[model samples]
Target: MNLNQKKSAFIALGQFLSQFSLDNSARKEGVLHNDLFFDKFIDLIELSQSHNGWFTPEQVHYAINSWAEALTEENLNEWLSAYDLSNVQPKTVGLILAGNIPLVGFHDFLSVLITGHKVLVKTSSNDQKLLPFLADYLIAVASEMADNIEFVEGKLENFDAVIATGSNNTARYFEYYFKDVPSIIRKNRNSVAVLDGKESKEDLVALGEDIFRYFGLGCRNVSKLFVPKGYDFKQFFEAIYEYGDIIHYEKYANNYDYNKAVFLMSLFPLLDNEFLTLKEDSSYASPISSVFYEYYDDLETVKSKLLEDSEKIQCIVSNNLINRSISFGKSQKPKLCDYADNVDTISFLSKI
Candidate 1:
């Protein structure tokens, strides 16, 4: 199939996703194929948690809403306008997805297919159900796409290129194993926020969304904080108190209890608000139920340090304190052009 055909299929998928939301999921009367597939999609979303506890209804709805907003014809056209895809040749691109969050690897899947290439996906065990179900939906919308998508069970074979997402350890293995093929091997990276003392209570509350959304699973979730030296924790704590209900979730409560216990046993100093804990550390990656923080004496020094360690950071959330930094609450709501790891997937696929 051609580019417009591919775009039309995804636009249809977007409309289908737009019908569902956390508060209300009424099927719209005019969405294509709603009579047949809409109810089944709802069934899959409801069954998602039984397959994986982390795939709660709230998280699933959030993912669906994000994609629904993204898959519009205007957004798709604006994103693709930057790339020259007319001369692209067809190839089979292998995808090894990470399952930290719902539909985490859908961007790469969309990229491969939209660029006139076939996709051979190997879904992560943690996220086995969601993507394949969506792939089936896409095939149903565009029967021609059945030839463009495949899910592999055993070894991945007969693919010309690859895109693999994993931890630093697995990334090394991917580099060595796919050494002969053109590839984009992603490693573990975490997002951080730089907080000035001047942020409003509203800003801090939004920051809570960045931290607590998806239970802090996705790489885009802010795992660390950079605050001014002697920054008071009073307002920060109060603003985020609205999200205190997050602790009631059984899995999150378990993590809170366990991590808090481990920290106390280790004699570590922790700032606790019952639901979330703040620990002073220099690392970018933090465990669930906690966020690591560091104090900055000067903004310029922090900027220099972040520039030096750019590769270790996925996104920097700030009030424009640093260049290209995202706003307080906007880290997780990435645009279509907000390429992961700052690598241009469309450009990469176009050349291949």
Candidate 2:
């Protein structure tokens, strides 16, 4: 599509989002947000007190919109137009979807779609419908997109390139299975925070969204923290305690209650904010039941630790890091241009 066409299409899609209000419809259909218009996708989070799944749907909506904005004809000409899609061969790409969070594999799917390659998508049973609905929406806007898309219930092996995301253990199988193909294999990665100890209560409360949203289920969710020595947890916890209703999930409630019991049994030190369960640990990610924190007196020391563990840390949330703060909602707002493992997916696709 040309720049003018792309921009025009984006306006149309954005307006459709406003008019037809798919988000409101999605909220009603969504397990999370069943009533409020603004509550649309934010309500579907499995464990947290459901507030429209914390934009599980709206985030997806904005991302696609952002992509449309960025992929205008002029932008494409600057970055992608020079690359030849016609002479370059088409690739058959296989996408293995993960339902750990909603639309987790959509980035890979978008990479395959936008790059003029064929996608063999393996949808997660837990999230069976969203992709199909999204694709249906896109196909209406771009007719050729359908020709390049395919959804498969089972797995397939023969392909030109692969992008697989799983745990550190499953990465071994991906590496061994797709040896010759150009691939990006991803393992567990979580976001973190390095507090300068000067954050305002308002920012700290917003940071709570980064930590507590989705009950810490996503890569962008801060599973761990780096704080100054003897930092008080009072303001931070109180800022975010209003989200207490996330414990409404019976299963999540059980896990939180169980972890609390275990922490008590082990004599672990914690701050029972009466809302969140915070414990001491040197970890990058947290489960639905708990959040972890560690103290560091030296800023340089914390920087080194963050860099050394960048492989494990997906995002670093802080008052000073603007880029990092932008990712605050990344757990929920993945877009079409973002490839799994942060790969240059369009570049990969142009070659295919």
Candidate 3:
């Protein structure tokens, strides 16, 4: 299909997603192919947890809502207006997706096909169902999309270039294996927040959304805190108390128990609020149930340290304390143009 046709199809897909929400799913009239996909989608959303325990219905719905809001005609235009895709030749782009969060690798999938290239996707086992189901909806909306999408079960070959997401160890394998072709190899990265001890209670409550969303699995989740020395945890803890119910989830509770036990046995001091634990750690990648924190004496030094460790960082959440930092609670809600690892996927696709 042509560019406008492709955009129209995705816009329809977005409309279909918009029908469902965390509070209630109100099926609206005029949505395409709902007779075939809508009820089945509800079933899939309910069935998702059985496929992956972390894929709770709430988390899955949140992901769907984010994508629905992102795929609007205006948002799509804003994101793609910078690229020139008119004269591009179609190459098959192979994708090795990550399953850390629901539909995590979809932007790359959309980028490859929307740029007129065929997509050969190897879905992460943890997220094999959702994207393909959506692809089916797209094909139904515009049948030509069928020719542009493929899912492989074995080795990925016959593709001009590849984009792979994985841990640092798998990245080495991707680098060596795809060394001959142009590729984007992604590795582990974590986000952090800078607190200056003056943030209001509202700010800290919003920051809880950043920490608790997706159960803290996404790279965009704030996994660490950079707070000024002698900062009190009292206000921060009280502000996030609203999210204490998160501890009631079975898997999260298990993780909390196990990780907390490990920390206690290791004699690491902790600030506990029954659900989440705060530990004074220099590392950015914290365990699932905990957030690591470092006491900083100078904001400028923290800024310099973050700049130096830029590669390991995915996002910086702050109240304008760090230049270009994402606002509190906004990290996980990245716009379509918020490319991961600061790598521009659209620009890469246009060139390839």
Question: Is candidate 2 or 3 superior in lDDT?
Answer: 3
Which stretches of candidate 1 lie above 4 Å from their native place?
A: none
Q: Model 2 — TM-score against the truth?
A: 0.78
The lDDT leader among the candidates is 3
Going through the candidates in order, what is the number of backbone clashes in each?
Answer: 0, 15, 0
Cand. 2 Cα-lDDT: 0.63
lDDT (tens digit, per residue) of candidate 3 on 251-329:
9999999999999999999999989999999899999989999999999999999999999999999999999999998
* Whole-model lDDT values for every prediction: 0.94, 0.63, 0.95
TM-score of each: 0.99, 0.78, 0.99
Off by over 4 Å in 3: none
Better of 1 and 2 by TM-score: 1
lDDT of 2 by residue, 204-276 (tens): 7777777765566778777787788989887877777776776776656787888888889999987776546
lDDT score, residue 80, model 3?
84
Which prediction has more favorable lDDT, 1 or 2? Answer: 1
